[model samples]
Target: MPPSAGVDRAPRAAWQAALRGAVLAVACLASTLAAAEGQPGTSIATSVASRPAPAQAAAQPAAIAQRIMVLERQGRARPQETAAEVDAEITRVAPFSAAHRELLTVQGLMLAEAADGAAAERSALALDDWHLHPGAQEAGLAAGAALLIRATFAAHGGHDLKRADALVQEALGRLPPEVSDLDRYRFVMVHGYIKDRAGQLEEAVRLHHQALALADQLGTPWRRAEARTALAYSYFGARQLERARQLSDEALALASEATDWVGLGRAHNTAGIVLDGLGDQDGQRFHFEQAIACAVRAGSKRDEARYLANMADFYLKKGEFRTALLHAQRALPLARELRDPDSELVALANIGFAHISMQHLPLGKRFVAQAIAIDEDRGALAGAASTWLELGGYLEQAGDLRGAVAAYHKHRKLMAGVLRADEQKAILAMQEQYDAEQRNRSLALPQREQQIKAEQLHRRDLQQLLWALAGGVSLLSFGVIVALLRRVRQANRLLSASNQVLRQHGERDPLTGLANRRAFQDEMKRRAADGMLCGTVYLIDVDHFKQINDHHGHAVGDAVLVEVAQRLRATLREDDLIVRWGGEEFLVLVQAMAGDHVDALAGRMLAALEGTPVAVQSRQVAVTASIGFATFPIGPASLPVPWERAVNLVDTAMYLAKAHGRNRAYGVRLRQAANDESLQAITGALEAAAQDGRVALTLLRTEGQAKPVEVAA
Candidate 1:
């Protein structure tokens, strides 16, 4: 059997290699444990010696606190063992004592770290109960640390990002001004991790930098290693692979020097990811192996499961399906044991991909569906979208066209929701920017008025002075007044021009030079007021746009968008309203065209984009769009649909085109009068509605296809 064989039949050489790697990891863990035994707050023997003879019972609680602190510093590799120790200590201490509360806090942190959410929640509740009791000490660093742990777990689990973010904020507020640098560093790192998970990469990087600075002040190799690893993870998220590699390398070296087993494991894992991104497959594998070894030595089932899953993903990508399945199978049980849904998701996905590649279609699809179910339950929209796309590709490869199309549709729908949320955020940001500019203008107006008054008074004083003086002085003062007047007039003209420019910029997307959503809103409002809202709405989305940006660069992506905008302009009628809807989406409003003309226009738009490759950066890159279109007053009875609802219908249709395949168009039209219930049903389930004869749909493909369209009416 190969090194990647099943758990029971693992190769002897691989075992020996793993054991060799574990030597250093074990030494590091031992050194950390030894150091913990001598720390001021963690020395049980010292604590016991300090207590008076008659107060020996009181000393036992203090001793237990010291022991718990020691176990905490010893690393999280053996959370179960550490937890057992905590449980034993709890029995030794008086119930509800200060020491007992400290033990409860550690227990909560341990459970959360291990991904036991239910038990951790219970522990958090207990802590809350204790805090509410009379004469209980103010919730301090320990409570804050526990909350941070829970917040991190929540964010990583994809359970509730908003709640996790709120919890972190609360935890930060709870931290005392006099908290130690180490404690503050941990809190900052956790906060950064949460922010990164929340898609705030820049903020996460900034927070990680703050943590690094604090670690530098503390001047400990272990802390510095941890900080660098965290910052490296943020850089990885930002897709700065080279910078991440550099930081991860530095972190690894620092951790090795400090004999920090836990930090070493994390650095190794981060390095593996960066290496994989950089296409260093051998380096990636080695790092993952070392990470697993370190995790094993540290007694951390959670880390072990994660590293194994990552290894499985690497093998799966390399086309070693059986090897990948074996690794994933091993990881799945460990993840389940730790109750880590996130790691379980990774394992299941890898296993599914592997099985599908090996021709186990039904079994693979079931596993993939299970993973997606978990993602949906956890509200992990991005994860679900990616998984659906992957499944679609596999289905397509397996010649299951119908299944592939269905999977793609689900992927497109989820991705559309994600994009919509992102668009909303962008709109809010633009609104904020506009509001800020308005505030600046408001503040400047008073100052400008005051300056104008001051200038006028100075002019009057100068005129009086000139009158008091001679003819030459009067002429010079007149010249000065005239020059000042001209300058003021120039300033006013410049200000007006600036305001006009701001308005134009606000209404247009800078990248594509097309009217933006704000302009679209204004046009819609105008149409509504005039009672002339009877246009065909088309929603066009650039296909695989993010991939283009990632593979090429954002600069190239912008060029593509610019080219797309120009192509759209060339394809549509001059009277059509073209707007940069948001992101890689565009909206077009064609003034009341004939029904047949609308369909023809949709086909023309698709041809215009797919006909020629876009010329950008001296390279011809193929660009295509998925288009969805609908004409207003669409039914046989000519029932009017609101412009908003009409646009949404077209948006759904566009996704349908995307689901079917890119470089195509899908248009929706009502065959009968659309009541509210029927419209809702159609919008909610377009394909199903089409199948059941609730609406008519037209799918337009590129020129080379066998048929121009397949109309379901």
Candidate 2:
């Protein structure tokens, strides 16, 4: 992926996309604006802007340097306009003094970061070289600023920690030991990013904290907000979601107070990601919109596209296929406009998935294939892994079981690499915790030892008077210590057990205490990996479940679902996997559907609940369910049937049951004929699924006359 493609790549929070370039730009704006209010910043522009100008920039090389620095900061805050402005300024400047050249070099870095390396080669200055400039203290400070910028490009764009480390070294070396608080803060922020990219997340987080403290020392709210945002980004990369969210909230408050739109947009982006993880779909969308609005106000096209992609993800989760496609399609052109391949890949992915949801198989598959190809070509292992997973989903939905299997295999392999990378981050987190505990223990140990010595000294007199009594007391103290150790061990054991239980419950339905759809899918994959080729999947839906909720309230509806799940479990074999698929729906998976097995099983499912009424709120609520089941592979040979298609088949059959009458069961065989496997046939079926309008009319009899009722596809 590109330097800033994390949010666009998907909200696992890689600190890319809206986070990196946008954040850097916003930081520049915030710091400069704060300096306008007499708060200090590392920028030569801020220093000059706070004081006086030195004649014409042409007359004084120092004045030219300051003007260049001011233009550089402005470029970040307004990339659309200032990119060309900075380019012209750099070109117009005749001879390069060390300080003047530093501004030009930093401008190149800002461009590269913003455009994801599109502007890296445009610099006349030696971007690769980091050396001290001969002049006053301000000249050294200029070199430090340039080093930080180059280091940013190296770390984020090139992923070259070695080069970045050298740049940072020069940055630190160039600065005097008594560096300005603002300069030191900027230096620390660059180092923190280097540490983060190197997978030293703990060190990275600490460096960000140091930056925050320096920001505070400057007595600027904007600087404080920038520090909080940087820390939040680090936490996000480390997957410390709660801490990330808290820091983002704090940063947002600061940004809002300052009316810093660029900073606020970045904060909103962070908040949106956290909200997505927490499953607050509405809140996530709201923040995503705010981010886009801020991005537009900040005159940042890249940010606009990034947030649009994120909004597509939000709509995808909501099952609004058309809306998701619209957002993704909108983002694709913007990404292309910037020539950002990584963001383009993600936009393609979003569009493909939306197409799949809309059941446009062939069209969706093409976009997915393109995205995957890009990932493979770019050596984007993480992006490739996620793209393959999306491909697997598309293939499965299209009933191409063989293709889906291949995609899944590729996904699993690439995903292992992704997980391995995270292992280092996990270890760092654990080590940090262990070190903290050791520090606490070390602090207490000295005090404890002193108290023990004092007690022994006091007991010397008692020991002389009564040796046996002293021995008895010593034994009692030892006994108490042993008991305390045992209790501590027991408490640790209980905590471990509790964590284990929490993990297990994470996949189960909270209301029904049954396996959820997620758990069911996992079990299906496990069974497939074990070479279990044949099974039956039953899709059961409660008839008029909404009416039940509307009449009896959601509390009663939930209670009824729990009862229904229990009844379904009672009817199924112990080996069968019963999943609370969704509201008022359950899925049952069992091995084999030979002979009359499917009919018998479906009958048992319907009878399970129809046999008795559910007791809810002291009222006997009538319960009836529609059942649909499908056989895997269609039983001609041993060819595997796609699980997604099997689910869809059963869903349609369930719809048929509803069309006929409530409280009935239906079954379907997987389409096994050669013609059914063709693209044309699949397209037709998918088209029908997409145009799910009620074409057939069902007769509803009331007393004597029969009223026509619509039946959906």
Best by TM-score: 1
Off by over 4 Å in 2: 1-73, 77-105, 115-150, 159-176, 194-200, 236-243, 397-400, 412-713
Every model: Cα RMSD to truth: 8.8, 13.0
What lDDT does each candidate get?
0.69, 0.62
Worst 10 residues of 1 by lDDT: 12-21
Model 1 CA deviation exceeding 4 Å by range: 1-75, 83-107, 122-150, 176-178, 239-242, 272-297, 315-320, 375-389, 408-535, 541-597, 608-623, 637-648, 658-661, 691-693, 704-710
Q: Candidate 2 on 339-399: residue-level lDDT in tens?
A: 6565677788888888877878778878877877877776667667777755665566556
User: What is the clash count for each candidate, in the order shown?
Assistant: 4, 2
Q: Write the per-residue lDDT of candidate 1 for residues 1-713, one digit (tens) a residue.
A: 11112111111101111100111343444455334443333322233334334545544544454455555545256655666666666665556666666677666665665556776677677666655666665356556756876785575443566688889999888877787665677677767766665556666778889999998997867768778887887787666778988999999998898776766887888887666556566887898899888778766666777778777766766678899899889889997987767677777877887888888988988898888887788777867877887777666666666777788678767865765645655755655555444434443255654565565666566556545544455456567756656665665565566556556755777678899877787787788874335888899999877556544554567788999999999988787899998778999998878877988888888888888998876878888999999888777877677665577678778867766667888888787787755675677578877887878898887767434455662
What TM-score does each of the candidates earn?
A: 0.71, 0.52
